[model samples]
Target: MNEVEGRGLCLHNNSNGNLITPSSDDDLRNVFHQIRTTKNPAVINYGASWCRVCSQILPSFCQLSNKFPQLSFIYADIDEWPESTQHIRYTPTFHFYRDGERVDEMLGAGEERLRDCLWLHS
Candidate 1:
């Protein structure tokens, strides 16, 4: 199987509260636009499967996704999207997007900090 398949990072049907991956910059932009059009903010977790910090934050990330269905929860793998890497630094970066524009970003995997940021954004 491919590395993407092994990491479970490949695209799958996105139901409510599902994680979606956008391959290219255009695709990522489209996803951001779609989410912004809904008027609710989006929380994008740019993570890598091999990163231990990312793995630890998955449960909280998953819970946040369910808690805020109005907000789009996107899981973007750094390794998968090289184009976006330049914009963001660090392994697990949290970006809040609204109106197709980035409103705020919180880097790293501290649960409390993430929660606080999400609360502030939403």
Candidate 2:
């Protein structure tokens, strides 16, 4: 089972869905910078809270963080960070970054598919 710990914006991975939420555009930029400079594998989930699909898959996205402890998990709500997320055209879009570059993207909500993708990258 997945247990989320803490709330609000977090820069480092912890118990809260193992997710790092950016509080501002600068923080969001920091996330990207850290991922690139550190060469850490990261999964960024771009979604809006109002979207049903996004809401449904969000918990799973957080839960999966526990399963893939090797990868960094980030949750970016488009509405909350519009300027940085304007490129997101779909709800619940998952972007995978590996070796400092965005390597793949998964659009939509599919638990199995997401799990498989995380496994591949993990």
Candidate 3:
């Protein structure tokens, strides 16, 4: 577990998922920058540990990351990074970005919806 800026959050590097947790405002900005600059599609899962739905769908989310190697997958905790989730209204919101722009957004923990968005965007 790699700590970022003493935020208590760890950036998981395990092979189970390539998900990244932005621990600070700058880190979050860098992630957005990468999403904008990268040619590949990017998806960010906005969630928190306390959210039951988030926890339930996390495994599926990680699986999706492994399933889609071409897309960049990220996990952002709304409680830890409020600024990054100002516009987020739901716990497990998935934002899809392509060509530096947000092409789609899915709210809730529905696996099928998430997969559909990924399939369409990624």
Candidate 4:
């Protein structure tokens, strides 16, 4: 998988949170592994490039990364991970992970709602 900052899903301690984009299934697994090992809270946005709602919330998602440096923000295109993301039933689905376990999930989009979710998770 092609990563902007390579290993650890770019979720390592940093001044600003990173929005990781995994290129392959292996990359996604590696990312999760890092999250699990580090026990860092993470948010994965499962969306499709062609989905209008996905496009709308993505920019806000990126901006939130800057606001919540403590959280790992990841963007996963459902199409790119067809096999790995088969359970995803909605565009712009968000999965929240903490202590290597998935704790919550949200589907659909709204900037304010997303910001609130991030705040709660962060």
Question: lDDT per model, in order?
Answer: 0.72, 0.81, 0.78, 0.80
Clashes per model (N, Cα, C within 3 A): 0, 0, 0, 0
TM-score of decoy 4:
0.85
lDDT: which is higher, 1 or 2?
Answer: 2
Clashing pairs in 2: none
Maximum-lDDT candidate: 2
Candidate 1 residue-wise lDDT, 30-68, digit = tens: 776687676668888988888888878866776666655
Model 1 segments beyond 4 Å from truth?
Answer: 1-5, 8-15, 23-26, 35-39
Q: How do the residues 1-122 of candidate 3 rate in per-residue lDDT, one tens digit apiece?
A: 45534544444444645566776767888999888887568899987777889877877777787777778888888877787778888888888989989988888988888888888887
Top candidate by TM-score: 2
TM-score for each model = 0.76, 0.86, 0.83, 0.85
How should the candidates be ordered by lDDT, best one leading?
2, 4, 3, 1
lDDT of 3 at 15: 64
Tens digits of per-residue lDDT for model 4 on 38-90? Answer: 98999999887678888778777877888888899888887888877899999
